[model samples]
Target: MSVYSMKTGLSSILKAYSPTEREKAKNIAINKVRFEMPKLKGILDAVEAVNEHNNFQPLNEFVAYLREAELSDNDFLRLMSDAHKLINDLSPKFTNLVEALISLPWTKRQPPALQAYAEFYIDIMVAHNKYVQFGIPKLISLWIPADGDAALWPNGSPIEALKTELEAVHRLLDRILTAIPMSFEIVLEAIESKFPYFKKATHVIAGYIHSVLWLIEYKPIFTEFVVQLVLQKLVLLDVNAPRSEIEETDYDDEELEENENAEIFEMDDCPKVGNIFAFLISLTTTDDDVQPMKHPIAHTIDICMEKMFNFLNTKNPNLLNASAEQKLQLNKFWKILLSAFDNVILPSHNTHHVQFLLFYYCSFKNTIAEAFLTSLWDKIKNPNISAVIRQAAVGYIASFLARAKFVHLPVLKYYLKELCNWAHQYIQSCDQYRQNGSLKANIVFFSLCQAVFYVIAFRSRDLTVDRKSLLFLQSLQLSAIVTCNFNPLRVCLPPVATAFAGVTRAYQLAYCHAILERNARRKLATVYANDVATPEETLDTFFPFDPYLLKLSEKRITLHYLQYQASEAEEASVVAGHRSPRRQRKRGDSEMLDDVDDFIVADKRQRNIELARSQEREAQFTYGLSPGFHM
Candidate 1:
C-alpha cells in the first residue's frame, strides 16, 4: 500500500473501532506502514505527515483512546522497543511533535496524553544530561570559600572552579525544573476537575512536587519564592503577592481577579491542597551533620500559621453542625491541619511564631475546649446522627485533644474538671441514676472521662523534666486516669462478690501511671535528694476521691492476674463452644438482671429493717424520762 493509503487506512480504523479494539487495528496499521511504505519509517514521516496535513483534530480522540486502552505486555514492549528504529537522531520531526504536545492546552488534555508527554519530557532530560551527575561533593565544592581554597581546584583558581560548579548545578537544576513544563499544572487541574475520583493522581502530582523540591537547592533566588509558593499552595492560594502592601499594589488586575473569582474550592480539594504541608515538612527537614543543609524559613512558617489560624478562627460551621458527608470533608481538613501542627507548626524554631500560636491557644483555650467538647457531646446526645458519624465525632474529639496537648496543663485541667462536673451534674439530675438503673448519661460522662484519660496519658509521655510541678502533675494525671476508669459499684456491708469489670482498664491506666511515676520519681530522687522541704511537702488536693486506689501498691499486679485468669477462662469457653442447656448457674449470679430486681428490693428492705431494729435497741435512752431503774 502507498503511504497515503496507509495513513487513510489507519485513520479510518482508529475512527471506526472502540478504544479496546484499536490495539488490533493499530497493529495492522503499523505493519502496513512498516512494510508496504518503506519510504516512511514508523515515527519520523508519520509525525511529518501529520504536521504537513494539518490534521491535529484526531489527536484528541487518539489521546482518549490511549487512556481507555490497556495494551498487552508484548505489544507495549514492542511499541517501546521498536521506537528507536523509527526515529532519526538528526531529524527535528520528533522534536517538533514533542513541542506540539507541550504547547497544546494541557489542562484540557486527557491525563494519559499528559502522562505520555511527561515520559517524553523525561527522555529529553536524560538526553540533555547524558554525561552529568550531581553529587554531594559537587554541591559542597560550590559552597567552598572562594579565596581560601587553592588546592580545591588544582586545575584553576578557586573562584573559577566555584563558578563552573555553580553553573553546572544551576544548569542541571534548571533542566530538571523545566523538564515537564506545565504538566503538573495540568495534573492539578485534573485533580480539581475530577475531584475525589482522581485522588491517586493528586498524590502523584504531590509526589512529583516533592521530588522537585528535594532534588534542587532552594538557596540563592529560589528559597523564599519556592517557600512562598508551597505555603500558598497549602492554603489554596495560587497567585503570588509581593512582600509588602505597597509592592503588592500592582498584583490585582482584571484578568487575575476574574481567575480568582473563577476558582472554586470544594471538599475534595482538602487532601490535594493539604499536600503542601507535607512538602513544607520536607523542606524544613535536616540531617545530623554539624552544618545542616536546609531549614524552614521563619517568614514562610508565619504565613502558613496565619493561614491555618485564620481558617480555624473563621471556623467551619459544618464542624459543629453538618451532615455526614459535609462532616467528612471538614474532618479531613481538620486532620490535615492537626497533622501539620504536630509535625511542623508546633516544633517550629521561630520563638515569636510559636509564642503567637501559644498566645492564641491560651487566649481562646476555654472557647476551643468548649466548642469541641460541646460538639462531641451534642453528637453523642443526638439520636438522628448515625452511629458511625457519632463514633467518628468521638474519635475526632480525641484527636483534637491530642493536637492541643501543648495547651498549659492548668488550663487543660480546668477544662477537664469542668467537663467532669457537668457530666456529674447531668447524672445527678437523672432520677434513674439515683434508683440504680442504667443511665444513658453515663455514655457522655464516660466518653469525656476517656478523653481526659487520653490527654493525661499524652501529657505524661511528653513531660520529662525533673521540676517539682512535674511530679505533682504526674501524680495528678495517674489519679485522673484511675478515677476516670473507675466503675461505680456501691460498697455495702455484704460486699457483693462481683467481678470488677474495670479491672483490665484500670490495669492499663495504672501501667501508664507506673511508667510516668518511675521516670518522674527517679528524676526527683536524683535531682531533689538534698531538698528536704520539697520531699516533705505533699499535696492531698490533687489525689483522687477514692483512697483505696492510693493504698493499693499491688493493684495493677493483682488486676493483671485476674485479667489473665478471665482471658484463660474465656479462651477455654471458646474452645468448648456451646454447653448443655442444663448447666448450673453460679451462686448470686442472675441470668436475667431485670428479673432479679425483686430480690434486690427485698434485700434493701431487709437492710432497712435491720437498721431500724438497731435504732430501737439504742432507744433505751428514750426511757430516760423514767427513773434510771426503768431502763
Candidate 2:
C-alpha cells in the first residue's frame, strides 16, 4: 500500500478496536512505517511522506516507533549512517526538512531520533558549506529591518518561524561547540571558509555562536572557545570604528524621529558594532550580587580588558571629537566591558588574578606599548593637552603602577621617578606660565600631586625610599608654590589645590610614619635626618612663612587669651556672688537653668517689642496722620 492507504487502513483498524486494544493496534500500525523507513529517502522525507495530509497520524506513529526503537551506541551509529546517506540526497528545501524532522515530539525525547536529527542537521550544513556560509548570515540579517532588507526576507516569512529555524540549527551548532563526536567538523570548516571577522556578517555570526553557547549546558572546554570568538569581534569593532565613515544622510534626524523604536545603531555607526557589546554582555552574564563561580576565559578577558583600558587611557583627539553618536557608542562599549570586568572577571578570581592584569598593562615598553609609561606621563605633563585626557592617562598609569607586582616594582619605581621629575619641571614652568596667566600648568601640577598620593597609598608599606623621598620633596614643592602664590592657586584651581593639600598631608603622614617605623626597625633616632624633609618640617615651612599665616596664628592666640580672661572674670564673679539672681551666668549648663534663662530672654524681648509698638502708634496719632504723613 501507499503511505496514505496505510494510514487509512490503520485508522479503520483503530476505530474497530476498543480503547484497551487501540494502543496495541497503534503499535502494529507504527511498526509498519518503521519497516518501510529503510527504503525511504531519509527519516525526514519519510516523516513528511507519511504525514502529508497534516492529520499527523503517520507522524504520531513515527514517534511511537522511535520511542520503542533501540538507542544503544551501535543503533545510534546505524541511524547516523542512514542520516549520512539521506543528507547526500538533500534538495533546496533541506533547511525546511531538517526543521520538520526536529519538530517531531520524539526527536528530543527518543535519544536515537534526537541523535539522528542532530547529525543530519550538521551533515546538511556541512554538505552545503558555501550555502551555510552565505545563508546563515543572510538569515541573521533578517532579524533587523534596514536598507530595504525587509523585502529580502520571503514575502510570508514569519519571525517565529525564522527563530525556530535558527534554534534548531543552533542546537546542532551547540553539539559541535560541545564536541559531541559529530561526524564532521562544522566549526573548523566555518572558521576556515567563512572567516567571520572583518566581514559584514561578523556580528551575526557572533550572535549565532552566542546562542549556541547560551543554550548548551556549561562545558568547561567550550568556555574559552566561545570567549575567543567574542574577543575577536570586539577587536574587530574597535579597529573598524575609526576607519568607517558615516554617510551624510546616515543620521538624518527626521528619518530617526519617524522610527523611534527601531535600532538606531545603523543610523550613523557601523552596522552591528553595538552587537559586539551585546555578545559580550550576554556571554559574561551572571546573577547580580553573585560571583561567577567560574573564571572567564582568563587570557581573553584580560586582553580585552587591557584593550579597553588603553583605549580609554589615551585622549584620541580624533575620537574625542568624533561624531556624538560614535563617541556615545564607544563610551557605552567601554562602560559595559568595564562593568563586566568588575562583576564577572574580577570576582571569578580565587586569588590575585589582577597580578596578571597588572603584568599585561605594564609589560609594554618604548614604541611597542599601546599606552606606554613615557607617553602617558608626557600626556599628563603636557599643558596644551585636554585636561580630561591628561587626567585619565595619569589616573590609569598611576593606578597600575601603584598595584604593580614585585616583579615589576623596579619599573614602577622608574616611572614614579619620571613623574617626580615632571612635577619638578611643572613647578618651574608654572612660573613662566604664571606670567602668561595660563592655568593649565597649575591643573597638571595639582593632578600630579593626586597621582603621587595614590601611588603612596597603594604602596604605603612597600614604597621604596626613593619613591617616598621624591613624593615628599614634590609635596613640599607644591606647598611652597601654593603658599607663595596663594591667591592664584585658590582663584584659579581651588578644588584641585584643596585636594592637593589633603593629598600632601596624607603623604606627609604616611612618610612620617614610615620614617618612624624605619628608625624603630634600626633602633636609631626617630627623627628623620635625610634630605627629604620630615612631615614636621613640611608643616613648619607652611607656617611662620606666610604673613597671612602669621596674622591668623596671632589672632588665634589672642582669641584664646581673651577667652581665658573672660572665663577668669566669670569665675571671679561667681566666687564673689552669693547666688544672687542679679548675678550673670555662664552661657549654658545643659540643665533647667539654661532653659529658664532662654525663656526669660525671649519674654523680655517680647515686652520691649510691645512697648515700641505702642509708642510708635501714639506718635502717629499725635501727629494727626493716618500712620502715613506728618501733619
Candidate 3:
C-alpha cells in the first residue's frame, strides 16, 4: 500500500527481507496474470515443471523443445515476460530464490541451475506485471549488499557463497538491466558502498548507462528513475579533499566531510537531496522538447562544465596526470569521469588543435555565443594530454552543442565557416579515399551533430534572419554532405556517426523542431507590435537600413518556390552566382568615412537656385527633376 524504503526498517530477524515485500510481490504476480491472462495459466505450469529435468542440454536444444511444446509467439513472449516477474520481486519466495541464486557453488550445474534461473525469472515476470499495474513499492528489494569487509554470517549460515553469486548478480544486473531490478539496485548499492575494486562496478554501470542512453533514450520517465537510483550516492560530492578510507571526491564539503563527484550528482550526499538535482539535470527526459526550454542534457553540460573546471583547477597535476600515466587502470574515481566524457564527446573532434575545432567545439565553451574558441583550442591540443583530459574536451563540446540547439541559440560564425570547410574537405576526399581503399561511406559519421547543424542552419535560420547567413552555411554543409556521400573524393572522415542514432536524421528532427518552434514563438509575440506600431523600429533593429519603400512579403518568396519547382532549377543556379542586392546602411561599412561628401544627397530643387547650382556635384540619383532647375 505504501512505498517500501531502505530507510524504514522493521527491526528484522533471519529473513533478510520483509512481509510487506512478500505481499507486494503477490500483487505484482496477480496483476501480470490479469494483463496477459491467456498465457498466465501456462506460465505457472512451466515454472512448476522447470525442475523436472536432471539432464542438461545445450541452449539451442532447450529452445527447440520449448518451441515443440507450442510456445512460440505469445508463449515465448510470456515466458520472457514471466522471467522478469520472478527476478523483480523481493518477496519471501524471491528472497529464497536470491539465496539459492547466490549460494550455488557454480551455476554451471547444467539443468538445475537452468531450472533455478527459470523459476527465478518466472517470479521476475510476476513482479514486472505488478510494477506495471503498481510500482516499486510492490517491487522486490532483493539485495542486501555487503562491502569488501562485510559483517560475517552465522557459523551454519549460507552466505559465504554470496561472493560468487554477487558477482553473477553484478554481471546479470548489467546484462539484464531492467529485467532484474532488485539485483541491479542491490549490486549498485553495494558497489557504491564497498566493492573490493571499483573497476568491476564502474564497468557494469558504464555499460548499463550507455545501453540505456542508446536503447531506452526515448523512455525518459524510466531513464530518470534509473539514472537517479544509480547516481544517487554521487550527490555527497566533497568539494574539499578526500580524507576517509573511501577515495575523496573532487570537492571539499565542510558539511558532510564527504568527497563528491560534482559532475554526476550535485548534492551534499544527504540521501534525500543528493542525486535529485543532478539526476534531474540528466533526467531521461524529452519534455522540454515540446517547447523551447533548456534540456536536462544542457543542465548536464552546465553541471559538467562547472565540476570539471573545478576538478581541473583544484586537482594536483600529479594526481590528475596519474590517469594519463595509468590509462584506464587501477582508477575508480576517474572511470566515472571517463564514461561520462565518452558518452558526451563527439567522434569528429578528437583533438582541440584542429584549425576549425571551434566550429565543433564552441558549444562546449562557456556559452555558445560567448565561448572563446581560440582559447579553448589552445587548451586541448597538447600532445602530452591524458585520455581523460581528451574526454573532458569532447564532453564539453557535445554538451555545449546539445544545449545551444535545445535553447534556440545560434552557434558562432567562426565555427560555421570552419565546419563548412571541414565538410567540404570530407566530401572532396571521398573519390581519392575510395581509389586508395581507405574510404568509408559515412561522412557525418559522427554527423548526428552535423545533421542538427544543417537543419538549424539550412531549414530554420534561413535567409532573411540576419541576411540568411545560414544559406551560405547550408551551401557548405550540403556540399560536405554530397562530398562525403560520393566515393571519388580523396578525404577522410573520422567515423563516429554509425553507432550513434541521434547524430543523424533522428537528431536533425530535434534541431528542426526546436528552431521552428522558437521562430514561431518569436513571431507570435511580435504580432501586435510589428503590425500596429511604427514599422521603422522593427526594420531598423533587424535590417539596420532605411526601411524599404515597398517591403517584400515572405509569401512572395514562398510562392516562387512553390510555383517553379523543377522548371526553375537551372535558372536558380545561374542567379546563385550573383549576390542579392542589399540596402546600404551607414554604420557598418568602413569606407563610409571616406565618402562623406558623396553621401550628402541634398536635392538641387530643394536648395535655393544659387545653392542648387553650387551643390550640383553632390546631387545623386535625383528623380523627376531637371538638373538645372532649382525651384
Best by lDDT: 2
- Candidate 2 lowest-lDDT run of ten: 539-548
Model 2 scores a C-alpha lDDT of: 0.38
Off by over 4 Å in 3: 1-340, 343-412, 432-459, 462-464, 468-480, 483-631
In model 3, state the lDDT of residue 172: 40
- By lDDT: ranked, best first: 2, 1, 3
Candidate 2: tens digits of C-alpha lDDT, residues 1-631: 4567587765333335578798888777767765455324335655455446444444444444555555555555555665567666555544443443333332223455556656665666666553454334332332332323333232212256445545555555555444433422444444334333333332233333334334323333333344444444444443333211211113244533443333323322442564466446544543232221111122222223333334333423244457887666544443443343333332231122222322343333222132345556777767687765565556556544543332255565667667766766665765666644333534455555556644543343344245655454454444443443312322211112222322334334322212222323332222345644232111000000001011111221111110101111122223222233432222111112211111112223444344434333222222110100000
Candidate 3 Cα deviation (angstroms), residue 51? 55
Candidate order, TM-score descending = 2, 1, 3
lDDT of 3 by residue, 1-631 (tens): 2234434754434455489998998767655443343333343343344444422222223333333344334444445445445453334322333333233232333344544454554454445443222222112122332233223321111254544443443344344445644544443344334312222222232222322332223333243333333333222221111122111221124412321122234332363464354346444443333221122222222222222233323322234456564443323323333333233322222221111112222222233324333333333444365534433442343333322322233444444455446446544565566633232224232232333232232222222144355344444453334324332111211111111111212222112222222333343455447565221111000000111111111111111111101111111222222333332322211221122122112232122233333223222211111100000
Which residue runs of candidate 2 sit more than 4 Å off their true CA positions?
1-82, 100-119, 130-389, 404-412, 423-446, 456-631
User: What lDDT does candidate 3 reach at residue 142?
Assistant: 23
Candidate 1: residue 135 lDDT (0-100): 19
Best by TM-score: 2
TM-score-better candidate, 1 vs 3: 1
What shift in Å separates residue 445 of candidate 3 from its native position after superposition?
5.0
| TM-score (C-alpha, index-matched) for candidate 3 | 0.23
